[model samples]
Target: MRVPVLNPNYLLTSVLFVLFGSFDCSELDMDGEISLRLEHSLDMGKSWQDRGSLSFSKARSAIPTVNQGPLSDENLSTLENLCSKNMFYLIKVTGDGIGELQSYTPACTMLDSSLAEQITLFLDWRGNPVAANLASRIGVVGHKVTAGKFDTRVQIQSMENGPTPDTAAYIQKMEEEKSRKMSGEKPDNRSFFAKYWMYIVPLCFILLINSAGAPENGGR
Candidate 1:
């Protein structure tokens, strides 16, 4: 006996759903004492599952010594280990009456030597300076990390900026930064629509087909 094949349109729709569903995006709200959040998605870019938490604080520091740079043999060795082990690390320092300082390094192992060098330079140049500037302004530093294939970018924001126009503005800013870093485009309506065109187009096609058949199918 021969089995029947699934309809092509059905197969296509299923594939599309799976593809779009595999892209897992998650948010971790760091509440207290170092925490680790893991999310995994099998499809290229559709949905994700939380893999539970790992105690990241038990590992080595995420941020290297500023004075040592990336070329230091110690730092290089650390980087090699991090790369081989594929680690994600975060550090948080909180002081009374002073703003908190947080650092995140994700997918630290994928970084090439050159990129690692740049990262070290960036940290040495902007990390402390930015933290000190925020400290002077009576603001605490809140760090967030988004990991990528080759490199990771960190964002440091002020926690004591007072009530802004909106409570969720920080999330929006982080989303924009992540979108920009991933797409090389600013987070705007156009970019958002572009990113989701696959879904939009398919929905539009279904709508058009149904609308065209509606009048012919019934009097109502």
Candidate 2:
């Protein structure tokens, strides 16, 4: 009896397909809120500056809300004003009819590394230590900023104040793309095998016949 040799090309192609498929589905378990970017400049009239952007998608969903009294149009206007302005001012967001107000300085220059540090510190006060000095310099008191149950919205009042644009629309579009995957889509059905299989298979049969007819280990 004679054992048949497997085609090397078939073996190589199968291995490549399996490796690519595995790499695509590696991270399918972790669940976290999507973050959106909020960038603004410090100057009010002149060109806008890139102060620093923050991701609020995760924060918005994670924070709890309380049942405050009816929100006045004035309050909504105030929060919207804070978000759209370019000055440096402090925003005191109240939760459940009780709120406190605080003030801070705004970034004077966009490229100012010191100011950038201050902003990062102010934002991260709830998380780390190096953030303390930065927050202090920027006049941001972590505990002073409060929120209400229904106060799920974020207020971005500037201390020195300037013109900040609402970039929510753009951020939402980008997030939508990031969470989408290529699964359930049609796979590529065109390959060397699919296009020329008929010809190749017949050629392979011919080769096998020729090989068998050549000799049997050089013995009769």
The most accurate candidate by lDDT is: 1
Candidate RMSDs in order: 23.6, 25.4
The worst-scoring run of ten residues by lDDT in candidate 1 lies at 117-126
| lDDT of each residue in 1-220, candidate 2, tens digit only | 9999976445634543453344344323123332322222223323332222233222323442222243234433443454456444231221222122122433332112222222221121111111111122333232222221121233221112122222344345334533553444454456747644554465455435423421221111
Residue-level lDDT tens digits of model 1 in 75-96: 3455456556765333333333
* lDDT for each candidate structure: 0.32, 0.31
TM-score of candidate 1 versus the correct structure, residues matched by position: 0.21
Residue 117 alpha-carbon offset, candidate 1, angstroms: 9.2
lDDT for model 1, please: 0.32
Q: Which stretches of candidate 2 lie over 4 Å from their true place?
A: 1-8, 15-20, 34-36, 41-220
